[model samples]
Target: MDLIAKNLSYKPTDQFHLNDVSFNFKNGNLYTILGRTLSGKTTLLKTIAGLLTPDSGEIDFDGKDFLRTPVWERNVAMVYQQFINYPHLNVFENVAFPLKQRKMETNVINEKVIDALKSVGLSGYENRKIQELSGGQQQRVSLARSLVKNAKILLLDEPLVNLDYKLREQLREEFKNLFSKGLADETILIYSTTDPRETMELNGEVIVLDEGKVLQVGPAKEIFENPNSLKVAEISNDPPMNIINAEILESEVSFEGISINAPKHFNNINNKSFKIGLRSSDIILNEKGYEFEVELAEISGSETLLHLKKGNTKLIMSIEEVMNFKIHDKVKINFKIEKAYAFNSNGDLASSPFRSKNG
Candidate 1:
């Protein structure tokens, strides 16, 4: 079974919530919708779940017209970013709600509920009340509820987004394990998140959205290594990929007052002005490198992100370890030229180091 959306467009007002979005989602694959807030990730998921009607589009599932189907009959389950559960119901009741609604026998409901709870590591907490559980546990209950249905379409809209960082990380790992074990092999799993790292961890097919428009779609590694455009690179990265104005002249790539030999990937290209893209991790502190002033230093977990500036160029450097640095501190840094990317003046990717030379 496959879910095919053709030219989906939803515009309640003047802004297009989903602008000409189209994709063929195959069964049994996990697809991550990665974008910033207000980027139509949630809107797209809601549309698929039959929660939002697109202004103009055709949805077909398993060769049947999906848009004409009512939300209740879609057999699609969605877990929202916020924990959604019936406060009056216990964990078991919440998980069994869908099966019970179908008027299944008690034995089948009990069996399915227990298995779903066990899959999400809440086997012994079946008797616990919704209010008694922590945020992570509550979210697990929501997931268990969806799992019990065994629906053909499973949509998770930032399900782990409201939890603490540590708990989010923990649940992310569990999600990977659960999905990797064929738990929902017959289901189409579509997860939406604004976190690039989370998308990277999932390591699934990625759809990069921005402002209600589709930017790029590919494997997570492909999108990460070779973003189709400048916006894709920025949205696919946490601190955003560092971009600087540069050009190729003769056999050298020059930017600001610095110049480096053009990478072989850019060989045979005509001399012209373009833009250079560099990941934060590709720029490192080097004593014998170009000088830049530290504008801001942020410490996140075990790493340090240093925002440096020199003349008209500014860059963010991701250091592997934590290091303290004050603003206005002079630091020399070097770029990993081989790991750099090139984009045309119009913001389209021209060359990627990950590809073969001149590819």
Candidate 2:
């Protein structure tokens, strides 16, 4: 099934609203909705599930109008942040609830429920009571219940948010594998998350949202490397994208007490002032670039995060190996100019030198 939302807008209250959001998605692909709190991720998901109607615009599924379709008639299933299961029902009974409601044959329901349980790695736990299982296991049961329904669209609203760190990591890998293994090959999977890393790990398409607005949508890596706007560059990154204010001259751009050759496309931008986006991974520690003092050093596993500053601008760099650098230590750092993203004074993407090369 193909899903399309055109100019979707919703205003439930003054605090939260979805403004002119639009996107096109098809079955057999996983999509991640990324944003901070109150960014309308949930609202958008609910709207797609037919739980909330839009004040304007229309939703089309496979060229059919879904705006007026009832929630139950949409063939959609949503797994929320909370694991909701009947305490009195066993795992099998819980997963078989929907099939039973449709009056499916007893033998067929048993086969489907068991198959779904095994798909989520909960095999042989069919008779386990909901209250007797661990939190992660219970959540698996919930996922199995959703999978058993075999809905055309599956909406996961931070379903792993409540799991422990280790369990969340394990489940993330499981979910990714399950989706790729054709368990729901013909299903449109929409997963919501606040963590940018989660979107990267999923390695799929992403839609960046902020304050009820759709900022950008594309392949995860593409959006990360070539954000369409300053807001997109900010929300699409973890530790956030490092932004520096700069001024464009005729042939050079000046910022942080250094001048670099300007891209030819800069001549088209009407504004002289601009913001440069540099990902932490794109900043290199070398002896040939600008000098900056290390403000802090954070070591995590096999990687180190260096917080460097020059004059008034702060930059963060992630290095694979541990560096013996202390606070206030002066170090030379350079940028991979080809990887830089420039945004105009109006916050829209102005120039990307490497976009063509990557395209």
**Top-scoring candidate (lDDT):** 1
Q: Which residue pairs of candidate 1 clash?
A: none
Model 1 CA deviation exceeding 4 Å by range = 356-359
Best model per TM-score: 1
Count of backbone clashes, every candidate in sequence:
0, 0
Model 1: weakest 10-residue lDDT segment is 350-359
lDDT of 2 by residue, 1-359 (tens): 68999999888776547899999988888999999988999999999998888888889997789998888899998899998998989999999999999999999999999899999999989888998899899888888999999999999999888888788899999988988898768899999998888898898899999999988889999887778888888888877889999876766778877988766545564337778788899899889889999999998667899999998899999999987889999999988765677787678887775463211
Q: lDDT for model 1, on a 0 to 1 scale?
A: 0.91
Predictions in order: lDDT: 0.91, 0.86
Q: Provide TM-scores for the models.
A: 0.97, 0.87
Per-residue lDDT of model 1, residues 1-359, tens digit only = 99999999999988989999999899999999999999999999999988889999899999889999999888899999999999999999999988888999999999999999999999899899999999999999999999999899999999988899899999999999999999768999999999999999999999999888999999999999889899999999988999988888887889878998888888755578878889999998899999999999999889999999999999999998989999999999988988888888778888889873332
Off by over 4 Å in 2: 62-64, 248-253, 260-271, 287-289, 294-296, 322-331, 356-359
